[model samples]
Target chain A: MADSVDTGRPAPRTSTHSLVVEAIENRILSGELGVGDMLPPERQLAEQLGVSRAAAREAIRVLESHGVLESHVGSGARAGTFITSMPTAALSRFLKLHVSLNNFDLDEVVQTRLILEVESAAMAARRQDPEILQRMGEELAAMDDTDLDREDFGDADTRFHVALARGGGNRLFADMTQAIRESLRAPLLDGYRAHEDWSGLRETLQHQHRELLAAVAAGDAERASQLAAEHIHTSYQVLPADSGGSRRQGNRTAAGGV
Target chain B: MADSVDTGRPAPRTSTHSLVVEAIENRILSGELGVGDMLPPERQLAEQLGVSRAAAREAIRVLESHGVLESHVGSGARAGTFITSMPTAALSRFLKLHVSLNNFDLDEVVQTRLILEVESAAMAARRQDPEILQRMGEELAAMDDTDLDREDFGDADTRFHVALARGGGNRLFADMTQAIRESLRAPLLDGYRAHEDWSGLRETLQHQHRELLAAVAAGDAERASQLAAEHIHTSYQVLPADSGGSRRQGNRTAAGGV
Candidate 1:
């Protein structure tokens, strides 16, 4: 509930630049300003928001980093800030840091992934899109290589999951599923690099992924979903214990490892 | 796979400020930076990143908006930038704009929600945390008011779902579930207002919510999951057709509405 936004407006408490940021974000969310719509010049925006030009510029830069807006430096109409649709990177950037710092625990990230990947696998099986299947097969094959290092294996592993998500034929689901998986990439890679039995763990993951992919390829929706869940459970179990432990121990998670 | 973050470093193509921003983000993602780690002084950071003071300041401002860092503006030891964990709003802000701009269609959004809420509801039934249940009950009761308007109902509806996610005992699940639900608030509210039979839609939603709540309360995990999925389907079915249709004509979808 704390994470939920109150639709009701609250009094501004931050700097003028943040107020300016909020002003633009509100417009985009309310659909008053849409993709490709240019914002006024820095001076005009400053005057409109009653903030300094520096504040306005700062606000624009902030939005740019979020991928919510794009800027072109020029003197003409083509050079102002424009509302831009943020890609999945915008979502993943925050998630990666959250996971890295244990703002989101390892267990919960895996849990969320299980929730998404299971349903996504089921949908992919139901759809059985050949192109997506081909993409997934390629990544799965790369992981099948016996000599693959941890870093290369990690890349292929991530792509394989993301490709499976795309087979579900839902862009938003695919993007979000990819975001969650990507957030765990660095940590999981670290886990693989540090684990006592990296080869054994890698071999186990390959087996699980191959079975899951086969289920998906055969259009066994139920089997695909169940295998997807099982794969997630196995992956979570393989993560290093220290990475799963919290610096801020609380009742949020019990003794459950996953 | 497009939404995925490539572990390989990309050549920086943006401004000096963006390079500075990237330097900070790279550190966070690599675990070199963590929560409460103080950033270097403005002048020092500018020199370290090989950027002007103004560029360094701009980069800091951008990171501040991402909620990845916080700053205290003073001339003392305790007054410097420090890494901070971003709340769910950082994720939701981009999602809201994406949905509002039709970057993510209603079908994908609802589908993603169905995946989350179903599993989340099942977990809620399994956990049955009393505090979370009571919070959910409060929201459910709030929505049960006969005189409640769409806005009030929407707020309660959101809180109820978020509470359900929390009851699952996964903080990431709760935060992400809240973020996804909040992203649709503005457009969904508009849909409610514009529809001819607002009261009828409201009543149907209330009934569906109550049934879902009852199943969760009964600690019937399978039944709760089923009911959660059904509720999502019903809610999606009730949305306006135009709202679900894409402004972009593409091969991504073939005439699916929710």
Candidate 2:
């Protein structure tokens, strides 16, 4: 197992800034430091840690990028760096890049999505909360309206699935599910745009959403799961084949295509 | 849906350094910049990007932390910064921190693992790759042997599961599954150490592993999935009551508790 901290510097490796960042990160992870807690002044931290100011500043810069730290502009107390809770955006960015880099293929992405959504749908069925369910209903309603565009439908569709994931009562899983689903928004929309029969596809999706909502509301876990899996498979079957391919091969951020 | 890039501001609302970094990151993600490509020299980049050398340097440092860019030390052809790929370690670190910060709760973590591992276990069974199977078999045998320490058994046990995750065709899922499982390594070992009947627990796990392997060998997807789920659930049941809860209260980093 990897150690909590890389304690063994077997050889001259990483860099001074990296090591400094790790040290501070360990403290945050260990709860010695916490959200809202201010870090020592750069010079003080450097002196205490026996590192140069440049190293300390670089470490701070790293943490700042990760959203683990925030800097306030002022003199005294508000001036220093403070620990901050990273929002889901950080996770989204990381996962997006990872996927774009071919860290996971389209098949893998689809399969992973299937597994998460199936379980999430099942859980949502078992513990259907009215508030969240209502939100989902709104998404379905939005899709059904005559003036709704494909992009709008796509965004609503994402929110609908995300609501189901959140209903599953797992934060990490929900965030991941949200990330994956959101990442596919552009590509899925591109496929939707390319569809010759938009009304037919929209009708099918609407029917599926209604069925899914009914299952969840009725607390039918098995039916919810089955519908969810079917919904995903049927929808993807209609997606433009080229849109599902790696968008990273060209000079477009996956987001642009989405 | 959020736009690909925030081009509203000529520069970002915050530090110029951060804006430069975000722009570069956006470029990289968009595939405008590919691996092995060299970045412009600091002075030229700063001037072209309408930022200072200090800001350019800071941007480089931030990207370096994420393993997106690397800088050379010597005054040679390779002395400039270049885009590079990061190993799964960077992803793991991001996930671990997010987990620690309660970006996702216990239920989320468990469900995410369930999604990844169940699929992975089923695939591993179907593939029946000799090397992975052999590694898993070693762990199973180690668990069965009475003289093995709790720590050793736990380590082996993690390996068995990790091997199964890697067997899945999806590297991203495997990397994520391995990272989440590894994060729990310390706590699982602590639970093993605290067990009143270590032999009994080991016996149970061994039986589960064998059954899981048998399912995989026979290409019984349903059985492999069921076995994997039960294995995780039973192991969680045996863990100390405080195992998951202890994380939020404190003890973020491993202090060698087990």
For DockQ, the strongest prediction is 1
Q: Which stretches of model 2 miss by more than 4 angstroms?
A: A1-13, A75-80, A244-258, B1-13, B41-44, B70-72, B75-80, B138-152, B244-258
What digit string (tens of lDDT, one per residue) describes model 1 on residues A187-227?
67778888888888988899998898899889999999999
lDDT, candidate 1, at A114: 76
| Clash-forming residue pairs, model 2 | A170-B108, A186-A258, A187-A258, B125-B216
DockQ of each: 0.44, 0.32
- CA shift at B137, candidate 1, in angstroms? 2.3
Per-residue lDDT over A28-137 for candidate 2, one digit per residue giving the tens place of the 0 to 100 score: 65657766678889999999989999888888887876767776666754566777665455566666655555555555666777878888888888788898799999
**How far off is residue A59 in model 1, in Å?**
1.9
- Candidate 2 lDDT at A49 equals 89
lDDT (C-alpha, whole model) for all candidates:
0.76, 0.72
